[model samples]
Target: TYITFPIYSGITFNNISSYVGIQAGIAASGKRDNTITTSINGIASSENQLGNLSILLPDFGIRAGLILKLSNKLNLHAKYYQGLINIFDKETSLSDFTWRTQQFTVGIRFSIRNTNDCGTCPAWRT
Candidate 1:
C-alpha cells in the first residue's frame, strides 16, 4: 500500500498534463516453506518451517513517480521506491538487507471542487 502527495503539475500540451510527486509506503515479501533433513546413526528425521525464507519484514520506503494525464480523469503512473529502513532483523541474520520496489499503474482521479473555482486553487492548477 502507498500514499502520494503531488507537488507539481504542468501542461505539456493541449489536453495533456504531467505531474510529479513524492510517495511513501510499506511493503511485504511473500511467505515461503523450508525443510531440513537430518540423519544420525542411519536414522533420518525431517523438519519443516513455513514463513519467509529471508529476513524481510514490513518495510517503509520513499518513492517518486511521474503521472501522465491521458484525460481529465485518467492517468498513467510509474514510480521507483527505495527502502528507508532495513527490513532485515539482526537477530535473524548477520547480513544487512534493504527493500526496494518499482511500480507502474493506471488509475482514475476525481475532484470535488469545480475546475473554474480559483479561490483556493493551487499554483499547479493554472
Candidate 2:
C-alpha cells in the first residue's frame, strides 16, 4: 500500500486541456506471500510460507495527461505515470537492473455545475 501527493498544472486550449505534474509518495506497508516446497531425502515434502517484502519507502514520479471537455459538465481524461526511482529493495545477481513503475490511466469526471458559467460569485469575493 502507498499514498501519493501530486502537484499539477493545466492549460486549456479550446475544448482540450493538457496537464503535467510531479508526484511524491511513500510505501506504507509491503508484503508478499510465498510458498516453499522441499523434499527431505526424497522421502517427504514440506511446505512453508514466506511473508513480508522490503520495499523502498520513497517514490518519485512524473505525470502527463490530457483532458477533453466532452460537454460543459463532463470531461474525459488520460494520464501516464513514470516512476523515477526503483521500488525494489532487494539485491540480485543482476546489479544493473532495477524495478520501476509505469502506469496509464483513463477516466471521466463529472461536475454538478460548470465553473466557467458561474461568472462572478458574491461568496467567493474576499
Candidate 3:
C-alpha cells in the first residue's frame, strides 16, 4: 500500500506535464524456511532452519512521473519510485538492498471552468 503527495508540477508541452512527489508506503513479503551452507577460512559450516529472509516493511520512497493528456478529461502517466532506506534486514551477509518500482496509469481529471483559449495541439507547447 502507498500514498503519494505531489509537490510540484509544470507544463512541459501543450498536453504534457512533469511532476515530482514524495510517497510513503509499506512493503510486505511472505515467510519461507531454508538452509545455507558455506565454508569460512577453509572450515565448512552449515546453518539450518533459516527464515524471514525478506526486506523490512513500512518503507518510504520518492516518486517522479510524466503525464500526457490524451483528451480534455483523460491522461496517461508513467511513474517511477525508489526507496530511500535499505529494507534489507541483517539476516544475511549480503548488503545493498533497496526497492524500486515502475507504474503506468490511465486516469481522468477535471478542470475548472475557464474561457481562456490556447489554440494549440498536443505537442505545440514543446
Candidate 4:
C-alpha cells in the first residue's frame, strides 16, 4: 500500500514546502526446525519432520510519512515502513514470529531540463 500528500504552489511548481506519502513492499523467508536440533542418539529428527520441504509465501505491509520540495522539479522525501512477514510451509509453523521491522528512508527527485532562470537562454530576445 502507498499514500502521498500533494503540496501545490501557485508558482507553477515553483517552490514547495512539504508533502506526505506512502508505499508498500513485500518479502518472505522460510520456517523450519534447526537441523542441529537433535533427538536421541544425536539424530536430527527435524529432517524427518519434513517441515514444508519447500516454501513460497507472500505478506502485506504499509508505509507512511512526509517530504519537502527544495526547488521546482527537485525535492526530498522521508517515510516510515512497517511490514508483517510470515514464513510458513505446509507442515512448518514456528512458534517464534515477528511483528514488524521499523525503518526510515530519505530520497530525492529531479529533472534534466536546463533552468532558464540561470541566464543560460539565448540573449538575442532581450
Which digits, one per residue and each the tens of the lDDT, describe model 3 over residues 1-126?
Answer: 344443545457787888777766664554567777899899988787746656666566677778887666556777776667666664563666554444455555544422133445443345
Better of 1 and 2 by TM-score: 2
Per-residue lDDT over 26-81 for candidate 2, one digit per residue giving the tens place of the 0 to 100 score: 87777677777776888766566767765576889998999999898899999998
Candidate 3, after superposition: displacement of residue 110 in Å? 11
**Candidate 3 residue pairs in clash (backbone atoms < 3 Å):** none
Error of 4 at 125 (Å): 20
lDDT of 4 by residue, 1-126 (tens): 223232332222345333333434434333355454557887655543433223324434455555566665676777665554542333454435444445688889785544435465565346
Query: Top model by TM-score, which number?
Result: 2
Which stretches of model 4 miss by more than 4 angstroms?
A: 1-24, 28-56, 84-93, 114-126
| Ten contiguous residues minimizing lDDT sum, candidate 2 | 88-97
Instruction: Rate residue 77 of model 3 by lDDT.
Output: 74
Of candidates 4 and 2, the better by TM-score: 2
Instruction: Give the C-alpha lDDT of model 3.
Output: 0.62
Query: Which pairs of residues clash in candidate 4, taking residues 3 or more apart in a chain or in different chains?
Result: 2-22, 3-22, 4-21, 5-20
Model 4 weakest lDDT span, ten residues long: 1-10
Q: What would the per-residue lDDT of candidate 1 be over residues 14-107, giving only the tens digit for each residue?
A: 5555545454444334566778899999999999988764544455555455556555445566555555665556667566664454455555
